[model samples]
Target: MRNPLDENKLEGHLRSVAAAGCQITLQDLEGYRPQTQPSTTSLEYESQYKLLVQRLVRSFSLEQLTQVLELYHLQPPPKPTKRKCARSIVEQEWNWPSLADVRRKKIDSEFSSQTFPLARHVSFLLLGKDGSQLRQLSLRHNVHVSFSDRPLSLKAEGLSGSLRLLEQDVKDFMAGITQETFALPVKRTISLASIQHISRTSGAFLETVDSQKLRIFYNKSHPHTLVLAKELIMQGLCQVTNLYI
Candidate 1:
């Protein structure tokens, strides 16, 4: 080993040592790793996320959109109504466990106001003018509800337990029986797209699908015949589960 005093001399000595036993591969300037991002793919994903957010935002009412936006630390739009518009606790009406034919203990609608508790699930079971079993569906609102003795008028009461009024009536009562009432049509069939598995949360599968397909009977209706389409769909579900097992 020799002491090289000058910087150039020391560098020359170290280069000679490396030439003797170094196994390093020099890097290519062109082969340098780039720090560029996949801007295109990132933009595509961001676009999809924005679309999903738009859909979710659209589904909510103005009030809900506000709460959600605020929760996520986002700026919400100006609310038209300062009042809290949470879904008014629409009372849940009592439902029938069994159909009329199998009627063992049915809710009596006669003393409905008195017999049934002031505000319990009031199952309004009605019988069609015809002997055929007609089901009565529930129309929400009562007690503090705007009371009216006005009789629901529909000429063609087609199916039993159901009411079918003129299309104009359908548009008129669009807020009550025609407005916002939940009734399941008695369908002897079920579509896979229709029935949903009851969520562990709600414990009830909202039969929104195919429900729209139900024949809407307008006018004064009965509770008995106003059966839900789910009644028939449940039958199909049992059949399906039996086969799989």
Candidate 2:
């Protein structure tokens, strides 16, 4: 090779080498080999990236969206809040995560919390009029989580351990059941797009999905339900309409 390091050519040569390295790296990671020739400018790479994202967004499901956000450190747009306005006057304002991002963090937190080996069960007794007994609901289940691109499959017994109260006195009405066990299999499939709203009761909630209402829960120490809820919300697949915690 000619003396490419000569003063006149060194800078241009180095720039060319750096660009080639970047192109190779991008091509390797993205499986986007240049069609006609190697990319000679950053603009080419940028255009390719934009096109890739456009294609991805069209078919991105809840799980797909979450993966992309985490991979690129991207977040959903921030929701306008009064607290943000109050902090605008300060030089150093509080930097907070978006609602969707909050759920991602919650998944991690829930995972950590479960390792403590604390009590994993809580039983609630519903009372009727005049403080009379209605029914007792027990939250007892082993929690496991499995994630995929489109649907979230919950496999295990006792998935319906959670409860939702849409109308008053509904619990009282169900108190007449003489069933011996409330444990039911958690083998269920969830479609995020079909969910309208999510309501949680600290550890459990009922929500409407595909016009059908269902309940889910995270036992005392297990946070699989919470993690699932947050993931759904963060992905914009479901909205958290009510939370009683």
Best by lDDT, which number?
Answer: 2
For each candidate in turn, the TM-score is: 0.18, 0.15
Measured on C-alpha atoms, candidate 2 has an lDDT of 0.31
Question: For residues 65-85, what per-residue lDDT tens digits would candidate 1 score against the true structure?
Answer: 344334434443345321221
In order, candidate lDDTs are 0.29, 0.31
Superposed model 1: Cα runs more than 4 Å off: 1-168, 178-222, 225-228
Cα error of candidate 1 at position 126, Å: 19
Could you give the C-alpha RMSD of every candidate to the true structure, in order shown?
Answer: 29.1, 24.3
- Residue 79 displacement (Å), model 2: 5.5
